[model samples]
Target: MTAMLEMRGVSKSFTGVQALRDVNFTVRAGEIHALVGENGAGKSTLMKVLSGVYPHGSYEGAIIFEGEERRFRDINDSEALGIIIIHQELALIPLLSIAENIFLSHPPARLGIIDRDAVYRQTRELLAQVGLREHPDTLITDLGVGKQQLVEIAKALSKRVRLLILDEPTASLNEADSAALLDRLLAFREQGIASILISHKLNEVARVADRITVLRDGRTVDSIDCGAQPVEEDRIIRSMVNRDLAHRFPERHARIGSPVLEVRNWSVYHPLHPERQVIKNVDFQVRRGEVVGIAGLMGAGRTEFAMSLFGRAWGRNITGRIALEGCEVELSSVPAAIDAGLAYVTEDRKQLGVILADDVRKNITLASLAQVAPRWVIDDVAELRAASDYRTRMRIRCSDVYQETGQLSGGNQQKVVLSKWLMTDPQVLILDEPTRGIDVGAKYEIYCIINELAEAGKGVVVISSEMPELLGICDRICVMNDGAFVGEFASGDATQEKIMRAIMHNKRTSNGARESDMPMEGVRP
Candidate 1:
């Protein structure tokens, strides 16, 4: 089969840093090719080059598409050639309707007038092709992250995209939603659309990829033919890391102490719908020197529960009693929670966790500046010392502490966020989706850090969508379903099957009760 896209001896540099060196890659028509690498290993950089974000004369490379040499000057040039790249951070306008978002740049305009009906009709057809049940008239903000991803795919299809580039498409999706998205990708493949998938989820990559390309330290290590025969995950991992990964998860010593943080009859109402409750009467406790993990699918209210208990940052109608070190405390606001020795690391780091334009030292000392400076007068020396301490402790790779946090890799940026919370010296730390976009090596380091926190006698509460990560790191796992804690199991006792079964059981029970109480309307079965 002839190659759909090909690159040879691709080398790219930025301000004296060589991001890509002598890289070679090829993608066949109607094939799903996976790109795997560590953080800062030049995966995104190479994709940017291909998508014309780097332009023609900026990088030294030869790009051949459909046996024709092409030099794209910008994203529009690449898009004209049927090459569209969907970034990890979605580029959808929240207030716009689905139809408008789909046909944003190139609308269905007739005679210099926008045709709304035509746009909706075309959008509906595209949505149906992607197996999305939502209407084109719905607003983008009204849909979940997974459904919004489908809209993104539909937008790509609108451009008649021949080569689709997806970076961590399923990073925010739940298990079922992730599976559904993968199925859609496979369906696209059957229609002869090629894809370049970049993801940290090796299992998902192994399941869908027709070929796997491994990159490390700004160079293409190897490309393996996953469709040639039985593809082994070990073979791919070896190629990517250039070593045998004896164990994916690190070892942990189980030593749980007395309950350090407790929540009794916790409940929170939906922010948008004030009357509807999101987190129903939940109860749990985390002991000192113990890592407790909250596991659930998307919309399971794990994050809601944590945020409500920490500082009432998310929900509106919050009714919860939080006790720390045997003393009940009132956490009405963020300051109140911090005053009560509590800290939370938000999942959306780029938007919420850090000030991107700020330097590392400034962001590190943001949360606990009062502690460093006793009076209203600022103390530069104290702040610098505190930030420098955390920089070394967290192994944050940067030329200087004054460097901008935005310039760092995903792993290093995550470390900066962690450092910010650690400087607060809270007794109970809540980490929400701590290892979301980072690589495998960075994940291991984070796991080690969590263990160290537990060893230091601090209570840790982890909320993760990944089942294996929860099982590997937590001392105990609590399963949440539909705004409630349905089941609890020890790390030693919990299995992926049991957790999934509990969620399903709760869903069935809830549905049965709802059906018995409420009258059936226009609901489709």
Candidate 2:
């Protein structure tokens, strides 16, 4: 394979913070090259420089494409040269049809008028190429996260993309969706389309990558060619973190106590559709000083149940009995829940978890303003002191607490959200996908935080798609399927196979079908 893209001596800085430092990256003509790194290790920054998002002359680098040096003034210039970047956040408009989004910038036009027929026809071909069966007329909102990802790829294909860049493409996808997306990449490789995949999921990287590049602290650490030699995950992890991580998860000794949080006959109806019940009658309990895990596939209502339990932030016609230390509490609103010693860290940190535009100090103190306020007047000194304390404690890598939350990395932003909730001094903390897009090093830090919370005699409920994570950290695991608790297991007895089996069993019972009739491949990671 020939060199498709080469970034030589790439260096980028922002406001005196060096984001990239002499980083070197290369991708072959028809290979899937993986770019793996810790958050803030400059992977995204380097890609932004290459894709012209940072533009020419702003970053120190020489971009060589197809044996020729190229200077791109903007993304359009790079796109014209067959470069397309799909960010982690899907850029498609939800209201628009798939066909429209695929050709939003460059539609099939006949004399300044969009040719709908041609657009739809081309979209169908692109979708087919990506193995998406949805019609071109289907709205992007109507599709699942996995299908939306495929549409993004099809859109890139529409632009004649020769070098495709995907950042955390499978971060929000289920196991089946992730597998399908990986298959699409393989198909593209066969067609001689090169791809640069930036992901924190090392398993997927090892599975599909032709070459793996490790970036650490804004510099290229090592590049491994899979065809030359088989690389173990331990080697990649050590290279990325610059240390031997003997265990992926930190060891925790559970000091189980009495129940801290209890829920009985909890149920929730869909907010949009009143007739549909999203959370069935469920009974759950988390003991003080214990870390409980909720394991389920996507759309299994894990998030729905968590959101509903935390002050009814989601769902309609919610019915539940929540108890704190054996005392029943009425949590009708967010404030009531907070007052009743309940805090929730949302899964979608960018959207619902934190105010990105605000500074870290503001975000950290947002949930518990009373702590920093005296007589309803916020004391700036006290607020700063409080924020500074949490920032240091959480190990949030930023210039200062005054820095904008949006400017921080994913792991740091998540810490800010956690800091905000911790400020409330809640007895029960519910975390949803706490380590979704972070690197292994950062994930270890988050797990340590969860253990710290549990050690403080707080009931911690963790809901995650990653089964391995739940198995590693939780004292007890609860399996949820189709809005109900299907099975429960202690950490000693829990296995991925057993949890998956419980899910299949529930499907068999609920759908009134044979066990063999249900497919479990899609749900298992």
Candidate 3:
């Protein structure tokens, strides 16, 4: 079979920074090509070149598609040729209906007026193809992340996509959703649609990809043919990061202490829907030198409980009794929460955690600006010194502290978030999906940091969707179902089966609880 697409001698640079070296890549007709790399490894950049995000003259390369050389001046040029790219950060107008988003660029129209019936009729067929059962008139914001992802694909299909590129498509999706999406890709292959999948989930890639391309620091390292032999995940990791990963999670020695932070009868109502209780009345505690993991299905109220406790970021009419070091404290707002020696690392890092446009130095000092300022006067020297120290200590891969956080890879971006919260010097830290979408090596490093945080006598609470991750790192696991904690297990007693059983048991007994998993996109592969 002849190749459908070929990139020859592709090299791109930005202001003296070489983002991609001389690279060669090829995708055959009707094949699922998996691209693997650490964050900032040039996978996205190469895709940008293909999709015309960087345009034709921005880089030096020859893009031969379907037996012809092509120079796409812009995204429209690429889209006109049946090439469409779906971004991980979903781009959808929340207020608009599903059909509208699907046919946003080019809708069926007569005399420059949209034909509504044609839009709905065609959207229904596209949605069915993607296995999404939502009505065409349903608002995009009403759907979960998983469904939104499908809508993006359906939108791509609407454009008559030939070469589909997905960047970190399943980074935020749960195992089931991720599996379904991969299966959809296979189905698309049956129709002769070639897919270029970029993801950090090695298991998913290994399961679905016909060919695997590894990129490291702007260079093509290897292109393994799965048809010839199964690709080992460790081998892929070694090529992507230039080192053999000895472990996914670091070993830890526990030194349990007395309860450092305690919460009693905590309750919170939905911010908008006052009648709806988001967090049920609950009692929770975190001991000094302890890493406690909250394990639950998506929308099981884990994040709601954490965010509510962190100065009621997620809910209103909150009622809670929080005691730190045996003294009850009132945290009515975010500033008060911070003043009370509490820090929360949010799950929605792109939106709530990091200011993407800001340089690393400013972001590092954002949470605790008082330290870098005295008497309301700015101190640039102290801030720079502190940020520089953290960049080095966290091993944040960047050109310098002056570089924008958005320019860093996912792993490095996560490290910067961690650095920001650590700078606050809080007594208790709450980390929500701390290692989500990062590479295996980066995950291990984050695990080590968590362990070190516990060792330093700072109480830690971790909320994660991955059962194995919670089991691997936490001293104890608390299972939350619906809006409350249903079960608790010591690290020795905790198992994925037991945790899941707790959830199942809760669902069976409570009338108000979700009988099935909540339709929220979560978990990391």
**Whose lDDT is greatest here?**
2
Off by over 4 Å in 3: 507-525
User: How does model 3 fare in lDDT?
Assistant: 0.89
Candidate 3 structure, TM-score to reference: 0.94
Tens digit per residue, CA lDDT, model 1, 1-525: 899999989999987888999899999999999999888889999999999999999999899999998899999999999999999999999999999899999999899999988998899899999898888889999999999999999999999999999999999898888999999989999999999999989999989999989999899887778767777777777766677777777788867887778777778898989999999877778889999998888888988888888788989878856778877778898989988889999998999999989999999999998967887866989988999999999999887799999988788899999999988888999999999988888888899899899999999999999899999999988889999887778888999998899888874323233212432222223
User: Which of the two candidates, 2 or 3, achieves a greater TM-score against the reference?
Assistant: 2
TM-score rank order: 2, 3, 1
**Cα TM-score per model:** 0.94, 0.96, 0.94
How many clashing residue pairs appear in each of the predictions shown?
0, 0, 0
Tens-digit per-residue lDDT, 219-289, candidate 2: 99999999999979999999988999998888998899987787877899999999999999888889999
Candidate number that wins on lDDT, 2 or 3 = 2
Two-way lDDT contest, 1 vs 3, winner: 3
Q: What tens digits encode model 3's per-residue C-alpha lDDT throughout 281-359?
A: 7778899999999988888999999998888788988886788877878888889999888999988888988999999
Q: What ranking of all candidate models by lDDT puts the best one first?
A: 2, 3, 1
How high is the CA lDDT of each candidate model? 0.88, 0.92, 0.89
Candidate 2 TM-score to native: 0.96
Q: Tell me each candidate's RMSD, in Å, in order.
A: 6.6, 5.8, 5.7
**Model 2 lDDT, full chain set:** 0.92
Error of 1 at 255 (Å): 2.1
